[model samples]
Target: MIDWLDFVVLSLLALGVIFTVIRFVLGPKLSDRVVALDTFNMIIIGLIVFLALVFDSKLYLDIAIVYAVLAFLETIVFARYLEGKNNDNS
Candidate 1:
């Protein structure tokens, strides 16, 4: 049987992803959108970790670690691109 706590946790995570997506879409500036994207990635990582806990599996944990590294790299690359863009505009 499914537990009520599971529903609550999942609902909250879903809400987080939703809100971040909205921010990314509606943000006035590129930086705000990037930050929203980063937040969305973090929330996905949280969901993966939650899955690891729910399934009692280490594989999900490893996936989460790899995802985190990639997400960090992605954010860094985007930041560099934005930096270069801003420099060109100035």
Candidate 2:
């Protein structure tokens, strides 16, 4: 059933979260870690949306939207910091 498929997708996303955690732990560069963190945030948002769809809860969708916006802002802030560091090194 389609519901079963959604469960599978959620499990796969959980695996992705684990992988991202590993990358965050082992990444050689700060940028590499930041990229992984960004990926994790995006994945979390996607999972939330999928859960909302499966549960037929409109509230979850709103939460997902807020989370996405916050994550995007966090990514932008980190990027700005990295840019500043690069400029300083130059």
Candidate 3:
């Protein structure tokens, strides 16, 4: 039941995930890797939402919401850790 537009969007999302993975792996700094991980989480949320739409299922959207919340919390923790590290060096 998926249309061409849906296919295109999914393809783009996949490509984005691939590039983000590269960034995550090759990032020279902890912050860069954290940013890439955050971006990857967002892309995964997008994929979940899109899949929910394509399959006409609300469950996927609910999962996406939970995942987004977790990702946000994780990002905050990472930020705090980085801040603490910086303070220790100062």
Candidate 4:
């Protein structure tokens, strides 16, 4: 059965996503937007973990871990692109 704690955690995670999305939308710089995107990915990962707990399924946890790895790679790729762009500007 779902509990209050789960609900509370899910609520917090949802709020986090909303705030990060706002940041992503209002970013004055591309770097700031990239960070916001990464943060959004992290919050989604948290949601996946929450789903896994609620469903009592290890598969969801596994999915979350794989998603986390992908998100990390995505962040690295964005950072590299920014770095190259900055170097070209200099």
In the range 4-74, model 2's lDDT, one tens digit per residue, is: 78778888999999999999999999999999999999999989998887888999999999999999999
Give the Cα lDDT of each candidate: 0.96, 0.93, 0.95, 0.93
lDDT of 4 by residue, 1-90 (tens): 548888899898989999999999999999999999998998899899889879889999889999999999999999999999999999
Q: CA shift at 41, candidate 3, in angstroms?
A: 1.1
Which wins on lDDT, candidate 1 or candidate 4?
A: 1
Query: Tens digits of per-residue lDDT for model 1 on 49-70?
Result: 9999888899999999999999
The per-residue C-alpha lDDT of model 3 at residue 1 equals 58
- Count of clashes in candidate 4: 0
lDDT of 1 at 29: 99
Give the 10-residue window scoring lowest on summed lDDT in candidate 4.
1-10
Please provide, for model 3 over 1-90, each residue's C-alpha lDDT reduced to its tens digit, 9 standing for 90 to 100. Answer: 549899899999999999999999999999999999999999999899988989998899789999999999999999999999999999
Q: Which candidate is the best by lDDT?
A: 1
lDDT of 4: 0.93
Candidate with top TM-score is 1
Estimated TM-score for each candidate: 0.93, 0.86, 0.89, 0.89
What ordering of candidates by lDDT runs from best to worst? Answer: 1, 3, 2, 4
Using TM-score as the measure, name the better of candidate 1 and candidate 4: 1
